[model samples]
Target: MKTTAAPGSPAGLLVLWTLTRTALLLCVLKVIVFPGPDVTSDVSVIYRGWYDVLSAGTFPQDDVTWQYPPAAALAILSPGLLPFLGYATAFFVLALVADLVTLALLLYAGRGPGRARRGAWVWVAGVPLLGPTVYARYDVMVTAVAVAALLAGVRHPRVMGALVGFGALLKVWPALLLVGVRRRGAWVSAVVTGAGVAVLFAVLMPGAFAFLTFQKDRGTEVESLGALVFHVARHHGWEGEVLLNYGSVEFLGPYVNWVSTGALFLTGAALVWLVVWRALARRLEPHTVADAAFVGVLLFTTTSRVISPQYMVWLVGLAAVCLCFRDSRMGAPVVLVLGACLVTVLEFPVWFAHVVASDALGVSLLVVRNGLLVAAAVLGGRRLWHATVPGWRGVAGVPGPAPAAETPVAP
Candidate 1:
């Protein structure tokens, strides 16, 4: 197997990054911009609805598929403002912009005194490796906000909160970052600002709360880790059925709801563990908050009843941010995450039919992918825990934290 290029070797890192960037750029050119009906449908179809909402100044209350918060309306309408750009082109441009912004953040942050470029390496490599799904969905926008929030979490806690709050409006997952905030006032600021923005939109937008009811009726998504159990059971005469619902592949038969509930319960349990871990950590490194946030998101993503292919983008994004911290010691786990991203691409557009059929290839893909996610989560969680433990001894001869692991820079 090919080993990770050494972090100390700038030449090796450059070569790898260049190759990843080129490959990703080509993937975008061929897959996203030049996609067939299936791909365009994902992008243009959603764009049309958002454009209509913007032009008419109305929420998609009547549309069953519009399940996001009212703040999402702003995101949907954003690309429409691009001058002379068609909806699809504008959407693609917006996705590219988000990707570029994330890369810029990682690159700039890596240049700081104590930071490392490994996180940038992760972003450059992981995003493209995730395939065209990066542009097919709006997840990249939320990821950009997430990157900004994490980079600012220590130095400017309130700013971090505001960014995360705005991100949560676009997608609920970003709010999870609030749990990683260090200061009591800072955490409160993030919560209040995020909640305040959400409440403001709820009051002004018609369909702001519509998503809650809509989600209540959702079946377990076929791609979720929970669905893996059903996929295996399908071979042994399980009666569950799979179908495309609410824009995702989901299980719609007996016990599907039960599986979803179980997943939610597990997620809740994970959150509780995280809160306790943060409270009790003996030595909390500056990077601990970002690393903890990464672990929390990994738990949320892997355990949730929905694991869209694009979900990998969120996973890799946070993982990349965490790896930027020199002391994160996430090298092994991040490599696994990158490998998982590649497998996800194969499991998705390449062989999604097999996945739907629960065939050997599909099941195998899911197995490898989900297993990696589980491993990444476990390893990442463990590394974060050890890194934060107070008075922890360093490896052998090393006594203090590594130079790259110094306190985070103030913004």
Candidate 2:
């Protein structure tokens, strides 16, 4: 869809250049300028290591670090196709492409009017605000799939199904979007499509389900909201060790695994809340699909035991898409989410040493960042619930229609 806003218009051009400049700058810094063991090196190790195995026409059957779904092999193996490019450079380029695609989708979605049009601005500004981490993780590509699937869910059921299925192969989170589908036909299509692709990958790859086995034993990452319990406890004479385990900074000691288990239970409760909310709600507006999806993701991400800095990109992308709808009530919560993203970057690549030390600065950053997330989660849940659930305001004696317009149709 073409935007009514001209390319040279102040809003459009500003957003375009902002994204372009940030991406170009990151490329220079990460690829050519910076020289250190950074996110790129981490990616290089994973993709480049796996690329060799793939080129030999075999799955990484023995590599425990290859802890993603088999479909991720497509991403891991892709750089081998570009024989001329270095693995690190190729990985950055690929991530950059996904970043741009996500920005384009957000821009296109924001072409409507009023606050709905601000969606593009949110996305354009949000990704770069995530700082260098934007191009560092494969999560950005999965976010692109999420953007496309949400955009397609309104008109193309099968397309939405295929996109969600494909995204699920890369990361488990994209499958959460399926709960927001309105029509039963669309729901079934999404499930069947996802299952079919997963089964195909399992048959073709030796370690397709290996990640599942590895994921259950993961420790509580230092950045997760759930990990705050251990972080606070460490100050009060908890005798735990902080170390990089299973590819993330985590707390490993007595009661650490128990906290991780508690986080999982919280996640399960969040899922049940979503299912019940959907069942009780009388309406499913086209825009509310994105809203509900954002809420779902917010619940999962916030409550999980291993929230990485890059995880903010997931919320930022979905929040922008949610804001694309004229009737979307996520305005306030989206602002909180964006603020949290900026703080996440600050806490990570900027003051990560402090985070590692678990000193005053690190704890403060965690407090602010995790506090914002909690606020966003609470506010986002309230907004979506009030919008979808009928007669909510009536309980407060503020009844009679509640001053809202009919839900806007998807573009």
Candidate 3:
């Protein structure tokens, strides 16, 4: 983590930072070349494919099972113009941009190497899972907006809302933060900001409002854990299918159907309860809020079937926010950083290999990758929860709001 050492910052720090960044960029270039570019490790490739369709001036029209929300197809229309260059190349460029944006957002939001190492860990963990769901998906685009929104929230609420709203347009999950904002009138700010985005989307895309509104019509995405249903049913030799659906594992599942509905609702309800409890516990002083929000995003990813690799970028970026706050007890942020790296490696590279192979080994890899992330989210959330409140005071100076029974640490 880069530090603003008072009086005398490390003399070689800037040089080291520049060299490190240059090396990483070169490494990215090498990775792209060797793997023929991981189009599946990012949403850019998928966006590129859509761009091919969009340049023809036809909205996804639900013709080819346009998996993503409509806003994404609209946003990625321009990149299709580079017909001479392959989709993989454009995808790489976008992934690089997303990586750079994540890094820049970390720094701009006041994160240091501690968080950066966590990001590196996530990158490594995710490298294996980098195929189809990540490279060929648009998770990063919305993820970037979510990150930028969180970063902006500290200094600028309006800015935060726009980023959050844009992100929400790409995927509904980013809207979760609307409930996370606790400050008086902050809700109003978020509403205005989100509404402004809705209006702009309408002006620009002309029927985007309709796209945003009738979300019910979108079909269940088999890529989510719903795929597990198909897999399990196939194993039973029930080849004939009925119109069974399980929308995104988070929101629509419980309300739409019978089998997974109660389960999904319970899961989402539990998450909501946790969020509300944590927030009302009033542990969310600015720094703690950052930490908790990072945890929230992590929890969301793990519990939901949509474990897109680029979603890790959001966790890494928000972790950067928490790390910048002098929140950890170690005085050395490297502990969290290293854990994040380990988990990311377990998630990405390992899973990507599994997804590519499509064999037993690959399935196992996906299972373990998901397991590690769930563990990370649980442990990380516990840490953040306790960190938010010590024995006597919640944070350094903040008063406690949660009952003492909930505390795990002494002052």
- Model 3 vs. true fold: TM: 0.66
Query: Which ranges of candidate 2 are over 4 A from the true structure?
Result: 1-11, 14-37, 112-115, 393-411
Clashing pairs in 2: none
Q: Residue-wise lDDT of candidate 3 within 1-411, one digit each (tens)?
A: 765632222323334434444444444445534233243433333455556666665555543335445466544753454567666555545654665566556544444532333332333333222333333445656666776776677667666766666676676677765445655444566667667766665565533534434444433332333334443444455433324232222213322244244335645964875665555454445554455566666666656544544565555555555565554422222234334444444435544443433345544544545555556666665555555534434544333455453532110
Per-residue error (Å), model 3, residue 185: 4.2
Candidate lDDT scores, in order, read: 0.77, 0.77, 0.49
**Model number with the top TM-score:** 2
Give TM-scores for every candidate, taking all chains together and pairing residue i with residue i. Answer: 0.88, 0.90, 0.66
lDDT (Cα, 0-100) at 321 in candidate 2:
87
- Residue pairs that clash (backbone atoms under 3 angstroms), model 1: 283-390
lDDT of 3: 0.49
lDDT of 2 at 403: 37
> For candidate 1, lDDT tens digit of each residue in 310-382?
8888878888887788866667778888999989888887788888998999999999999999998888777
User: TM-score for model 2?
Assistant: 0.90
How many steric clashes does model 1 contain? 1
Model 1 scores a C-alpha lDDT of 0.77
For each candidate in turn, give its C-alpha RMSD to the true structure in angstroms.
4.6, 3.7, 7.3
**Over 4 Å off in model 3, which ranges?**
1-46, 52-58, 67-70, 78-91, 111-136, 203-263, 328-360, 387-411
